[model samples]
Target: MKALVLAGGSGTRLRPITHTSAKQLVPVANKPVLFYGLESIAAAGIREVGIVVGHSAEEIQSAVGAGDAFGLDTTYIRQEAPLGLAHAVLVSRDFLQDEDFVMYLGDNFIVGGITGLVDEFRRARPDAGILLTRVADPSAFGVAELGTTGRVCRLEEKPEQPRSDLALVGVYLFSPAVHRAVRAIKPSQRGELEITHALQWLIDEGYEVRSTVIDGYWKDTGNVSDMLEVNRTVLESLEPAVRGSVDTASQIIGRVRIEEGARVTGSRIVGPAIVGAGTVITHSYVGPYTSIAAGCRLLDSEIEYSIVLSGSAIQGVRRVEASLIGRNVDVTPAPAVPAAHRLVLGDHSKVQISA
Candidate 1:
């Protein structure tokens, strides 16, 4: 079996961050969420991976060049547009070449990795397999209704009224028979080939479609809130170490990892947190569930429950929490000005000004 990772969606929900960067590249625990998926695929012992890239193909390619970092030989498959998941399978046919493969969504974070699922699929060799988890909002995902025999009975993508809460978890394993199913299904009203429709066709054709309900941590990091939550979850398991310097004036508490060349002075870091390599934390409060990425500088500020990417400097900012600060950003106080209000009120509008 091979691996096919999809990294090509235009993440409009995460703009203006997605406007400038790929959503897959967003860091969770100081590592790109995409990298975690790739690492998981590698750990599953199946190589010969193909990455389906679209709008941010260049960025994805640049970061995953040759795939040596993840110990796999990767081929970049270009998807011309933001077509659906089945379309990605259709375009990657040449690379897949009749081989059973695992399709992993690049932006999705599954805490325990896919090794167990991959092993099960390899042993069972099912016609198709899907990972499902019960979600609160099944209408927002591709949902499945399973039968008494543990077979997939029905599937729908983003239905207003869902049959069940068993939402697709963005990780799928398919045998080569899925190619015929993809070709048989027509594009949905959304003008793209829906993977759910293809899977439905497989069920209609009497193919074996298996599913596993995951009880572990999994998240689709498509929005800021989910991204921060995943960051916190990953940080909770961080190993405490101080490879760098923690001066006499600083207080390091809990499960913190201070990487090489990082320095902490006059600061109080309450972990489950990490200060990445080359980062400096001085006179600030680095609170729990926070990850300060490499080469960053945090001075005279207090940040907790947040992610500060590489080269970012948060100086003199009073406090930041539950935030996603992007790469190379500078967070400082704006110049003070007299308080005033300027309003353009509508006709017959009741307005009050605080002065």
Candidate 2:
């Protein structure tokens, strides 16, 4: 079996960040979210992979390259627009022809990886297999209704009145039979061909469809809170390693990883946290569940439960928590003389200011 990874879609939910960068490239634990899914697919032992890309195609292609680094020969299939998941498969037909493949959403994070699910699908050879997880808000996701025999009875895309809370997880396994299903369905009200509808088409036509209700952790890192939460969860299992310099004035505690060339001076870092390569943390209290990306600087500031992306700087800040700072961002103490607020924001940007 091969793999098809969807890295398309304009992440409107992520707003200003997605305006400049692809949502799939958003870093968690200092690694791009898309990398996690790719690593999982490589770990599943399905080498031949095809990545579906849209507006951020150049960036994604640059980061992933030929996929040699991930031990897979990848093919980049360009989607003309941000159509939808089913549209992605339709465009990737040339690469996925006549082969059973797994479709993994690039920005989704699954704790254990999909090796087991791929193995099961390969053995059973079902016409279609989907991963499902119970979600609190089924209306936000493509939901599935199961029959008495524990089979998927119906599927709906973001239904107002969901029949069940079993939301479809990003990963899906499918036989070549899905090619016909995609061609048979029409676009939903959203003007895009949803994957859920294609699955419903298969079910209505009596094609064998199966589902696995995963009990493990899974996240669609689409928004800020979800990204921060996923970062915290991944940090919880971080293996402690110090390949960088920690000065005599600094004190490191708990499961912290000070990556190579990073320097910590006169600071205290309480882990499940990471100071990325070449980053400098000085005279600060780096709290738990935080990840400072490579080439960053934090001085006389206290931060916890946040993610600071590459080349950013935080200096003389009182404290920051549960935040997502983007690349090349500079955070410093605001001038007291200018009591008034100043702002430059993009479309759909959200900001919370202290009154």
Candidate 3:
């Protein structure tokens, strides 16, 4: 079986950040979110892979060349526009051929990988197997309804009133039988061919559809909050390693990894944090769940539960928390200025000032 990784969605929720960069390329623990999906696919023993990219296709192509970096043979398919998930599969038909394949969303993070699911799919060979997880807000995701025999009976994408909380995780396993299902379905009211609709078509037909309810951690890192959460989750598993220089005045607390060339001095860094290569942390407080990317500088500031991208600097800032600072950003305190209370006084207007 091959793999079709969808890396093309326009991440509207990520706003100004997505305006400059692809959401899938956002770093979680200093690693691109898309890389995790690619690595998971590679681990699942799927060597031949096709990545459907749009908007930031060049960047994606450059980052993942022949897929040799991930030990897989990759082909990049360009989608002129991100119409929908089903549309991606439609465009990638040539690359996918008549083989069974796994479709993975690049920005989604699923802990424990998909190796077990892939093994199960290869054994049973269902027409389509979707990974599901119970979510608090099912309305935000594609939800599935289970039948009497524990099979998927119905699927809905972002329903107003969901029948179940079983959300469709971003990983899908499909055989060549889905080709006909895609052709049989019409575009939804949104003018895009949703993958949920394609799966519903298979249900309408006499095809076997399966579902696996994942108990492990899974997150669709679409918005900034989720991205930060995933970063924190990944950082929690890091082992303490100091390849860089830590001055005697510096105090490095638990489970922190200081990459080579990074320097820490006169500062205190709490656990489950990472200081990337060439990053400098001086006279600052690097709190837990913070990731300082390569070539960054943190001086006289306090940061926690945040991700500072490569080449960024947090200098003289009082505090920053739960933030996703982009690359090359300089976050410094504004110059001090004299403060005064000024008011435009009109006739019969009274103003009180405390000296």
Instruction: Identify the runs in model 1 with alpha carbons over 4 angstroms from their true place.
Output: 342-355
- Clashing pairs in model 1? none
Error of 1 at 19 (Å): 1.7
- Pull out the clashing pairs in model 3: none
lDDT of 2 by residue, 174-289 (tens): 99999999998999898999999999999999999999999999999999999999999999999999999999989999999999999999999999999899999999998999
Per-residue error at 42 for model 1, in Å? 1.2
lDDT score for candidate 2 against the true structure: 0.95
Greater lDDT among 2 and 3 belongs to 2
- Clashes in each model (backbone N, CA, C under 3 Å)? 0, 0, 0
Please state the error at residue 13 of candidate 3 in Å: 1.2
**lDDT, residue 223, model 3:** 93
Give model 1's TM-score versus the native structure.
Answer: 0.96
- Where model 3 places Cα greater than 4 Å from the true spot, the runs are 341-355
Deviation of model 2 at 111, angstroms: 0.7
**Model 1, global lDDT:** 0.93
Ranking by lDDT: 2, 3, 1
Q: Model 2, poorest ten-residue lDDT window?
A: 333-342
